[model samples]
Target: MKASHDLSGLVKFLSRDDWAFHFEEVMGDHFWPVMDHFDLDHEEINDALGDHWAMTLWGCAFEDFLTQVFDPGGQTFVEAYLKRRSWKESAQSKAYMTALGTSVMSLYEASEIVPGKSFLARDLIRGGEPVLISEGTATKTLRQWERVAARIVPLGGKLIIAGGLLPFSQEASDALLEGFKALPGKRRRSRTQPLLDDEMLRAAAPLFTHAFLFDVLPKALGETRPIIHNSDGDEIVFHEVRFPLATGITRKDIAWRLQGIPQLRQENAQFWNWLDERSQKGPLKARVPNALAAGTTMEDGTPVLGNLELKGRFLTLMVNSAARAARGREMLENVLGKMVGVPLTTIQTIEQMQEARKGRTKEVDDIPLEVATPLVHAMLDKQYREILDQPVGMLGDISPRSAVGTQKGREKVAEWLKYLEFRSASSQNPHDPMTTYDFGWMWRELNIENLRR
Candidate 1:
């Protein structure tokens, strides 16, 4: 379940309040040394400078410098902090993200050259990255860098990272490709060329007035190896796939058509029991087969082709292995094609049923509940025990039962209960599949009742 309001706003609120986090490291890295170099006339200020509280003044001054000297005003700092937030949220960490994000933003903004008044920003470190705001390639900045380089090249404190570490995703690769085109270099994708930072500085002498250094750990040399995933009984993988169903078939016809597959017949021995129970009469009636069963949720809460008033529903399939998933999909497509006669159109969604459900006024009972329930069970019987232990973001990045161990996690579990409550009370026109679900299992599994009290 999604939060009613986005969580990003909460991050921003936290970033603004935690000022010490942003400035603590930078004060030690640059401010104290810079202060030592400057001659102060005021004895009172000088006496207060040795105290730990003095760093607060240094941080304010640095922020002010970033706002005035770097020209993007103060917005660049905000953007950097947001990036920090994004990185932190992606992992389960919190503190460094907001603090470092804000610090990086200001670092970019305040990174310009004051000619002779302050040292060239590049002279402090080398490359401008993680976001560089005050980077300038002006003639004066270039000449100053040339002078600095002549002085420092004999000594080494820099290393050029050359391209990026690790592989780039397609979208990220595309962006880098486009960006590389603008730089003064050949855009060869396959070449593994390395240029020293000293040579690069000599080539593009007047770099941006960026003063930032990352405490980056070098990647271990040698071939990158693929990590092998070995799952114990406690760890199981689930795959959700879509399969096409044949049109003009009823619930009984569906059971027969799917049962026609040798794999389905062999894998599920309970299929006959379900079909026999659905055939039974009186109030002991079983629900209609909802293509499959409860363990696997349908894409749009659609019934099998037999009940379709407007169009056929896609069979929502799930399996634990890639091989089984693919085989199941191909088999379903092949078998349904034979039964339907018309080329079975494999659908990924049930938008047609969604539309049909919307226009119809009555709570149409297309299929009985008794028959549908057991088939759902047959689909998930193998994986049900492990499902409760899997961590979900909706449960505050903890498993359901684990969420009850702490007060904060319990609050998240309560929120999850509220979300399910919303689902229970709601419907997708007449096609709500949640009604078929027994949610009591969740409460009992998590041991999280008595929330109201």
Candidate 2:
């Protein structure tokens, strides 16, 4: 049998009537957060999370139980088990049991994963140099920079992860770290001494399980679909309203009429943008203000309420919400009264647009490599130039420049930068322009280059 199967057998052995109390105590602590958060009892939680996750949680508790000392003399379940059943197990199993008796569970950041082989794990909670771990099953699925709360044990001269591993999302990891820092006696520590001692980490093991559940339960229970709204607090729905121009009207006439309105900015002969002038002045003073007065802007601070483009005889107006589309249509009708014909409107939900975008391939012309490369880079540079000063939803709707002014905000910005860099590097196409783009400048701009690792 595999070593993990033997570990499972040990867990089962400890769950008998003689050791039921300790089993209940550890499992109770592990599952209490899920129960308390969802207001569900033991059976209901199992029904909600299903058998797979429930057993996974149980395994986490079992691993935590291995490190606990039930008696004043420091005897643990593994020690007690070996005392009685040592003769039945092989030498390797005995050694494994002994290792488990002393193993401390802590969170680790996984990297350089090689499927079906191994990966490098750096302890995030205990703070140590990264060590190569020979793991097969987990390496199949573990992503680079993913955090996992698990135990590493030396078995057969190789460090391997224990059976109980709880992978943590960035949100979960942040919650766990915050919870750890809020614990008594940890608040006064400095940066270099951020690592927790083995004893403290082991004692705080239940918090790791709690944080993971807090991150996962909402998603698993179907509560994570965000209700997105525009700055006007209107639920976002894409509205494409097309107004056909009158026979005698020309592009120049349309542009001249549009220019009379202060909100419209002419981009080209065929295009004009309906803009919110207030957004160009500076960052918003407050959220959820006048939607018409304070419209949405791109990352580079181009305040666009909607887009208008001329095609054949049709003048298409694309806006986010129905309210904006209606407003846009009325404004256009008033400006170019007899110059425009009847309008044709098409509406799509945000979810539908997203679904339609998936697997849709764009057709690119075969431009010369030398020309394409510089053009792509220039576009990217322009797009990201004012990104630091603009509000980002990922950084809690605050500008990165503003976010870096505080310690907690700085941490969030660092993680956001790392995520952006990771996604840019993960492009499937090697020749993709994004694959070669450097985020080093962005890190330097934010003054968090030192935390790039």
Candidate 3:
């Protein structure tokens, strides 16, 4: 479906402002209580970048060109933002329901979810009686045990209620069996079930536990797609992936190196080559899009003779976990090349931030500068940090407790994975998305020369 909103004028209008302020304003108005969940306040948002307009200058041109030139058919911010909201709300509700059931089930028999109170161990049902289920399967079984135990207790008999993960915990199970055997009764009829098959209990047997239900089972049922905001005024669907964010070169490191070597800029190509060689020897984990460049080839079956620059506006990066966030700085250390312009131009001062928060005394903390690193590493770290902390529909900003109760909860448990994919509605390098063309005709000569040669 096509979007009805006009993004061209909007894009032009936004481009004129300091990109950082625009982003901060957009996030502040739209992210809401969701942003609060991550402990990020308005002042912090304003302080995130040293150069508010850096991302705008570096990332915008490609996006603008993509909408205005390459692909005339475009979408808008309003539609995209609304779609993301819907996805987030739906996912949150689903997660909450599932987690509630699982949590209650875990404590079943020994204790129950008492509408508003905590579980009571003394009210367990143990004998044969008609069962009534008010809410859950465990509650029904508990009712049956209660009735049976009452009838048998008078005749010096016993009863046992079952259901819930309590029966599986070594401590709870042992305590239950001991209690059952020691119950006061002339003819005690303890609740019992057939033991697990010998084969099922073998050391090597693949065991399935309820934690698996809360942790791994949901993905098998298809709840991994998350709603993520994109630059082209839209939200994109993404399959979650986890990765470590710790460790990386960093933007400041690059800046320091570049600044230290005054002659580095005199030979940009040579400097890049030397850096690339060191990176090959450096102890760093290569990531997606960045890694994609190492093997990219041209349409005519020829590998292009150029370095891959993971730049531009319309890039959707899936930062699935904290590891990616922590290491993001190092990844961008002098290697990432450049970022979109809007984010870069939005840099703000402590004074501006204080002015913005004039009414709210609590938000007057001075804006802290982002850790400076090389352009590439800083950008990588920034993207990783943003995704690490940004409130995506499924995993980024939802309450940990809320997530555990639904599909989103299950996805959160898989935060150790590190798979990322890049999708773009607009790009300068259609053939090589990792890079962008700052000067439209700049690469044409290189291609023509390669052909002639």
User: Which portions of model 1 show Cα errors greater than 4 Å?
Assistant: 1-367, 371-385, 428-433, 436-438
lDDT of 3: 0.27
Which regions of candidate 2 deviate over 4 angstroms? 1-5, 15-18, 187-189, 223-235, 239-347, 351-417, 424-453
Q: Summing lDDT over every window of 10 consecutive residues in candidate 1, give the lowest-scoring window.
A: 209-218
What is the C-alpha lDDT profile of model 2 across 1-453, one tens digit per residue? 455338655766766545778878888888876788789777876676789877877777887888888864568888888877777777788887788778887888886678899998888776757788999899987765678988899988899987778888655776788788878766345656655777787888888778887767766777457456665567678999998889988877887888899888676888878876554332222243212123455433445789999888788999988998989999999989999999999999978999989977765777866678778878778767678888776577789999999888887887777666555555676567776676678888889765554
Q: What lDDT does each candidate get?
A: 0.34, 0.76, 0.27
**Candidate number that wins on lDDT, 1 or 2:** 2
User: Roughly what TM-score does model 2 have, to 2 decimal places?
Assistant: 0.63
* TM-score, cand. 3 vs. native: 0.14
Give candidate 2's total backbone clashes: 0
Give the total clashing residue pairs for model 3.
61
Q: Which candidate number has the best lDDT?
A: 2
Each model's TM-score, in the order given? 0.22, 0.63, 0.14
For lDDT, candidate 2 versus 3, the one ahead is 2
Model 3 residue 382 lDDT?
Answer: 50
Tens digits of per-residue lDDT, candidate 3, 403-439, equal: 4446545444222111121111023433332222121
C-alpha RMSD (angstroms) for model 2: 7.4
